[model samples]
Target chain A: MSAPAASLDAVRPPVRTIGRDGRRRLLAAGLVAPLAAFLLFAFAAPIIWILGYGVADNELASVWPRVSAELRDGGDELPPDEAVFAALAADLRGSQASRTAATAARRLNYALPGGRSLVTQTARALADRQEPDPGGGWRETLIALDPAWGERETWVALRQASGPVSAFFLLSAADLRLGADGLERAPPEQRIYLAVLWRTFAVAATVTAAAIVLGFPVAYFLANGPPALASVAMVLVLLPLWTSLLVRTGAWVVLLQDQGLVNGALMALGLTSEPVRLLFNRTGLTIAMVHISLPYLILPLYATMTTIRPELVKAARSLGASPAVAFWRVYLPQTLPGLAAGALLVFILSLGYYITPALVGGAGDQLVSYFIAFYTTETFNWGMAGALAILLVAATAILYVFYARLAGPRGLSLG
Target chain B: MTARRTMRAVSAALAGALLAAPALAQDSVTVVSWGGAYQDAQREVFFRPFEEETGIRVNEETWEGGIGAIRARLASGGDPGWDVVQVEAADILLGCEEGLFEPIDWDRLGGEDSVIPGAAQECGVGAILFNEGIAYDRDALPEGPTGWADFFDTERFPGKRALRMHPAVALMGALMADGVPKEEVTAVLATPEGEERAFAKLETIRDDLIFWRAGAQPPQLLASGEVVMTTVYNGRIDAANREEGRNFAFVWDGSVGSFDYWVILAGTPRIEQAYAFLEYIHRPEVQARLPDAIAYGVVHREAADDIDPERLPDVPSAPENLAVSVTQDLEFWLENAERLTERLQSWAGQ
Candidate 1:
């Protein structure tokens, strides 16, 4: 019985070693698994969690759970019923004791201009007070501590912010607020973010168009010129890309300032009597952005242009077409993919530029990303940062969809 | 309110956490502060000497400065990785309430009288004092600007000027320039009409203004002749003058001044060493060394006795400089930051 079994076990070695193709596939997956895990945890997860904060309404409710509960079940009362007040009283007492009242107050303040002080002041006033009943309920006590608590607006803000989910930040991104009656325009004094969003788009488009115009000739020369010249030119184009973005922006500052090299040269050449206002305005911003983005446009355009056969344009010219018509009809269409890819690249990169503009451009010329940085670093308002980020991602996605539609089946590809 | 509650609530939980805490290999205390040149100066003045004098292994790290950073570190476990941290004034107030910091023993720091007014807090001791004032490149603007008024009067100064992008110092400076008394700047700013008044003053200079975000940018802006005058940290102007021989003159009139405090994170095992570190920094000798390294004022007023009398007027805490300066009303800004920021941005966009 043992002799046949022993022979079968020895033959099973080939099956254990497995197929060569399967082994290769396993090795490839093993090599890529670390990168895949890194992208999931470090990159994708944080992005999703941050984006979640854009619409999340957890701050106020999480800090004052009892108040959130009362609001969820409070029905259609103006200043909310006495039960809501009692719940708020209990919640504030607990939050105040835990020193989390300020945290809850901060979220409320995002909706109401002076809500932070109001909530903290009230909580502090009630710090040592016993819980009130029907004999003397919290409605009177709360209203006395701050008369704003008696107002319908305060209750409404609380109700909206009492959330499993809410639209406060998302709506704010559009320069709108969530009123009891749905959406409302933000106050005139506060309606700047929407304009900032538009400015971001405008700047990105300007940079993209400028880069294409400036880069196309350079790209054409690199593609059609001698191979040795193209290699040297390629190195020159990538030189700026190798430097820190901040350094490149700083170099622009030195070149473009009122007393800087460019202005000095212009004055010496008798181009102007005085230094033109080029350092901290849209003009300067466009020039610096174009300089930084030109290489990106040139690289891709050259890649696609090199692939186009010169014989196609020559054939069109031989068929009795004018040189301009031949170039436009035959040669230009072939480079469209790269041209589209370069524009998309420059536009998206320019959209997120904050440091360059913040350092070199005037306050009026700042993009939406500046405000995102402002909120994240300066104000510590993560919800607002998340809102601006979501606005940017959404706008970029929509633009990408539109660009893809226009490009059609040939599509945009970074060659 | 927050300090008392946070201390009680967190201390109770922290008591149990300390039992599970692991033993350290050395008697080292890590202190975190704002990085760059400021931190380098701190190392030379406070960190290096403290290690030699007390034999406590002083470990140092730098942060970009945020309350959120402190909150994350302390909330991970009561024993925050770093022991003593230098935090902004608002963070001291906010963190105290959240119980992220250990309550200071004023007796250990030679009592509350040892420090300047507003330097002593329930949970923190003031580590450094800074002032933001109008600094003009003397070469560019031959007639140096005297105050925030000249800064706003573009016709008089005759060129673009840079102001901090934030409304905190800008609003106070604007109110002072608009003729509100230095002491009453925050009081007037608390009212809606006063808010509009400050913005109106800023509006006068909006076209002629470029905003700066970083402390280092203002000096660079001046050096580049991008602006004639800028609202800049006094220390930055001093550093530029000393290092680069840049003739930038700082005007103390209508300056906005604030403090950065040293706080011990709650439940740190190095409580005694943390106290010793705080005490060491407060010593008049140690405090005197700071002003020479950087132009910032020493927290201890008595440190002036050791400081060169000639250098006294250059600091924010000097009576002459303090008289003209407005201590930044952190509480007022904390309440209205969002409103003022958006309003300023809206005005700028227009």
Candidate 2:
């Protein structure tokens, strides 16, 4: 077998193992331990805490020891919780406590919107009831009454419930199920976030795909072209990065607005009857995003393509392959790592993007990062915001894993 | 052997406590505020004066980064970062709800009479005053767009308008456009139908508006003629009109008034110093200098007397401006902010 002769040198380890190996290994371990500890303490621990905070109230934490012990010793979970509910029922049933019940009933009545008196309804149920049914579980009772229950979902949910952490938030981001009972459903009055999440993904993916498709050919041309022209092409790519992000986004707004430069030019050339609604729509969003992120894709792809030998295509052609076949089979395969890197890079960057989308994108065009910001700054709902961030990170991690698997070991070099 | 180990652990804790003894004893007060001109003015008028009067050192911090930064410093489970924090009135309400801020001692704040009568007894003391108003390009309009009514009359105006897409202010503006009386805003918003009505009203000019979310964009958009008019911070408009030579005019009519206040965070170590700082900042002479620097109003009523009438009208202290502005119901905003913002975001995103 004609094994590649150069493989022998590549197989050799750069450094030999000796007395120094243990000291080197020890130093490396020492260096990494603090980093790992810092990451856990600073980043991971807080994230876990934030995720746990959604369902776990501080009062629950205070009672955790008793609660856990009771659960472990086979004490009833629902009965104690239902005891509170029964006490609430009893309090509501008491004629003397009618004012409080009426007040709560009035509040619930407002929510129901012109429905019959809530207190009267509760009274009827209480009058009809024999004993308050505290079932084997709170889940069972909540499910029975709500019918959003008894689905075997919460048990699987609890197991899948993740951590001191959860996927409830990520599920909430898409307006999906946290459990059988605890779905993050938008009210009938409010619009669903599931569509919003889908729209955001579609917009981001479109922007990334557009950038790749538009940027790839330009990058290829620049990569294979003469050095001076290549430098000029590189300048064209680098120019936008030097400008402020707001400035670039603003420029797009000017170019795409109803009476903007592009429309004015088009009108002057008699292309259409009126200016187009280009500035504050998905078109404007994709245009601005692609303009800004195009360089990100091109630079990586150009770097990868430039390093490929021109002779590979020539060699393939010389070996009896057609020019198109030679180029596609020989040259294109070499650039897979770059394409993967650029696509993933652009996709992830586009997902968390804020300024460009905010500047040029309309209300419907904004991505999920806008909501993350909205929650953090406006609502100050740190838990929800943290949960959204965790979801984005999880989604990105899953994507990276997916990409890594698709690309194989050598393609992992893109990272 | 285990008992000895436990004893050692207890001794180490005691040593750690002893190490922190001097810090516990020291009469140091920290005040946290939004940094920039505001911080500088507070340092000059409030902290420096208070420190000078009492000989207690004032440590100042900025609210530029993370809220957790403040929380973590406070959660050392002892003395917190700030004796006083300059928080938005809505944030002060939330902080009070969560037990994050101390209740103001009304007697300590000069029995609610020394400050503006209606303002002093709230969860916070009004420190800086501002209003949300329409800023229009004078050159573009030709006929001046004077009020929120004119702002929504896109037919006459016939130009793209921008508004800060913040739910609270935007919804309020929509209600004003829908002709809800100023005093009834909170009461009206309390009802689900009223909220739906406001959202529906905003949907009218939804296409015409280029929703600006950042503080900087409205002014930039106005200047660039991308938006001929915008609802923006009065100071941003005032600064652009005066300094940038932008042909702009701000109409205070139907503008919602807002104020930033100083409040003591709960469990602060330096309550006395915080009180001292508050008293210092509200002094008329000390408060008068702020309008010249930042163009926002100081809450000191007497401070307006020193400011020129021409200047005061454009400043938040102006009597004309005050007449046109409505006081924002912070408590109402506080209770409804979360659910309202969520709904608003859902609607806006659609």
Candidate 3:
């Protein structure tokens, strides 16, 4: 028989090791280079930079460079000395001229309550004066200008804010603060974010659990039932994919309002006498969020369940196991990975929900995302928002790793 | 079709004039404001009249862009394209401090005394005044409330009521309901006792209060009877009644009002034209026409007298409404809003 050239090349066994094959390795790297660069800059870098704002304290540094630089070397316990005071006076004059005094004042105000008056009032008084003496007069003159200027807390906040970066936002996000000794829980009256975060986690977990319970049986039907009916039901399940979130949310608002169709139907059936409280509460939020999140859980689970063969359960049933025993022992165990994955996906996605909760939830039902939005839009406090978002993303990333390990071969396949 | 054709011709003509005779063309400055009915009202009264009175062409633009837009322009260091902008009160205060707006030429634009209180500013003049007040469906709560005090009295007008989610208005409404004088609302809120009192008042009916964030939610809530009354922007109620024939009315007593100011961007080359346009717009006759078209009141103090008596109770800036209204303290809120909101949030969650 005449062997072709391809057959002879396939039989050759003299190939070098992959490590020694520099050209192949280089070609492989070149193929991946564009994607690697894109992710590094587009995805990874921005995330890292934003997360850095949690600990990065740079308000005073940006607006009052001289004072920030001076305070970097000074003791936190002591009030800013005459030299630091002179730097501050000079910086305030400079900041006022440059129109940045408000930015610094606003930032300091977050740290020391109502501290805006301290910086702005001082700036106004200092703006009207002649140039500072750059001597001992700054400490006294500044205090004379505003008695609050003499307070230790103002100096401490100034020193704290004078940063390359610090843990101020991160600590504040946890409702903890850097006290005299170190980090301490904020007073009971002011403590908020920890509760908000707990509420956020609890809501996400509840939504995840509910989605699984509702979605699993449907997923099994789609996996095992007649093809045409399964496909149609799958289409119904996925109808939300094309609809906008606001539209879906608005649909719930229509269906679940006090005088809406849901109540009307129930009343007509004589199921209830009065209108039910469905909107603007936890019940409304869960119903809407679960409806929106169900597709994410169902599709992944259906995909995983379809791959499992039916013969194992049949074999177990024929031998000795009852139907329930066969399903529990043989079928359910096989589906655990899919269930965990679906639950995780729903949980992480639910954590980022903002608008649905805002529209459907009462004030008490609002999650961490609400506080992030409040900080961003209402207060324009980017540091606080960044801290909250960092915490949220951190929680999501950890769960994602566990998911990746469970769905190892098809780790990135969403469906 | 004819209107579109005319607009196309006007835009073409304006473009050609810019390219062909850039120097010789009449001075035209871009004025940006919050668009829609407000801009339409302005076009009829201010822009059209100013263009007719002076040979200078008027270029009108509109934006809801906040102070950051101005900051972007400043950073770019070019001709600030928008010569005169209608800015929110907070932006005016912040921008004026930053010297982003030109000092108002009080003499050229008539005396500063000509404008209403809070309308006259260091760098800008108030363009319009709008109010947020307690509103109810006349069909639902026909008795009508005397003041904010009646709003909190669930025993009296007892039904679910909504307030804007933010602490600012709700706290003010609570304090006013609890018998703090409307004029003293801001002063009382300055002290810890005032904040404590406001929250305590809120706590009495805390479980009963429903909070809404969107401006549109209030009217819907009222129409559905989910809420009997709500803290609504007066314009929403006015528009709802006019558009949907839903008879809603504002309890104008003890309302919260704020201003939108017309400010000249600092270092504008068309300073002359800007001041002229501003002066023209603020004329009592011109200012008087705005209230008829929209619910907002005029900025000129004398303009209040010119507004038709029929529209008095409907407008937020009317002297009758203005008398009982409280202007939010920009300086005080800037200092305390964050902490107080945090306090309110912790309280709400509990």
Superposed by TM-score, candidate 1 places the C-alpha of residue A67 at a distance from the truth, in angstroms, of 0.5
- The parts of candidate 2 lying over 4 Å away from their true place are A1-171, A176-184, A235-278, A315-326, A393-415, B1-30, B43-59, B65-70, B113-118, B266-270
lDDT of 2 by residue, A248-283 (tens): 987887788767888899899999878877877788
lDDT of 1 by residue, A1-415 (tens): 9999889878877665567768889999999999999999999999998888888888888889998978987787869878889889988888989889889888899998789888888888888887664467789879877899998888889988899778888888899986656578998888998899898999999999999988998999899989899888889998998999999998998899888899999999999999988877899899998998999888888889999999988899999999999888888889899898888888989998988887778777999888887888777888888988999999889988888888886665655
Q: Candidates' DockQ values?
A: 0.58, 0.18, 0.64
Worst 10 residues of 3 chain B by lDDT: B16-25
Stretches > 4 Å off in candidate 3:
A1-42, A131-136, A179-182, A398-415, B1-25
Model 1, CA-based lDDT: 0.84
Worst 10 residues of 2 chain A by lDDT: A107-116
Docking quality class, candidate 3: medium
Evaluated with DockQ, which candidate comes out highest?
Answer: 3
Share of the reference A-B contacts seen in candidate 1? 0.88
Clashing pairs in 1: B2-B97
Clashes of each: 1, 2, 0
Global lDDT scores for all candidate models: 0.84, 0.67, 0.84
* TM-score to native of every candidate shown: 0.91, 0.75, 0.91
lDDT of 1 by residue, B154-215 (tens): 77888888888788888888988899888898999999899989988988877788888778
Interface RMSD for each of the candidates:
1.3, 7.2, 1.3
lDDT of 2 at A116: 16
